[model samples]
Target: MAVEYHGFRVTVDAKADATDTQWLCRAVLEGVEAQSETAKLPCIELAIPKLKIDVLMALSMVEQTAKQAIDEWWHARQPEMA
Candidate 1:
């Protein structure tokens, strides 16, 4: 994914691998070297659930995208499955 705002251009690469269990996936995100930002972010779990919900939602979206892509590829080769 690539995004440009103001004068800065950011590009990211993400990879997800399914675990032995189908419901969970391992995800990793890497930013282009030139655009990478390394910083310590705050986490306050006691006050709100926003952080956890946002993370899970993003992961769910990624999983959905992967599932759609794989289904398309599989169905194209086997029309009967459609």
Candidate 2:
């Protein structure tokens, strides 16, 4: 799962071992920065190290955050649709 804001992308995934109930989340943000005279675009990747958490917690966090992001993105376009 992922969310994109202002041309930047944030991705989330969960991983677990069958022997253990613990899980972790991996995430990345892809976008550009101000570095040179011109512009730099993404797939310029910035990744987060694995976060130790439960699978359900990881999934819930990702889902809630994505929904909030989507809501904000949708509201931002309301004026343009009018």
Top candidate, metric TM-score: 2
Residue-wise lDDT of candidate 2 within 1-82, one digit each (tens)? Answer: 7765545456767776464454554554454323211322222211223355556666656645554553454456465653
TM-score of 2: 0.39
Candidate 1 lDDT over 9-81, as tens digits, reads 3232333224322223232332233423331112111111333444445445544444444345446746897
Candidate No. with top lDDT? 2
In candidate 1, which residue pairs get closer than 3 Å at backbone N, Cα or C atoms, i.e. clash?
none
Instruction: Report the Cα lDDT for residue 56, model 1.
Output: 48
Q: List runs of model 1 lying over 4 Å from the truth.
A: 1-53
RMSD of candidate 1 to true structure, Å:
15.8
Cα RMSD of all models vs. native, in order, equals: 15.8, 8.7
- Candidate 1 matches the true fold with a TM-score of 0.37
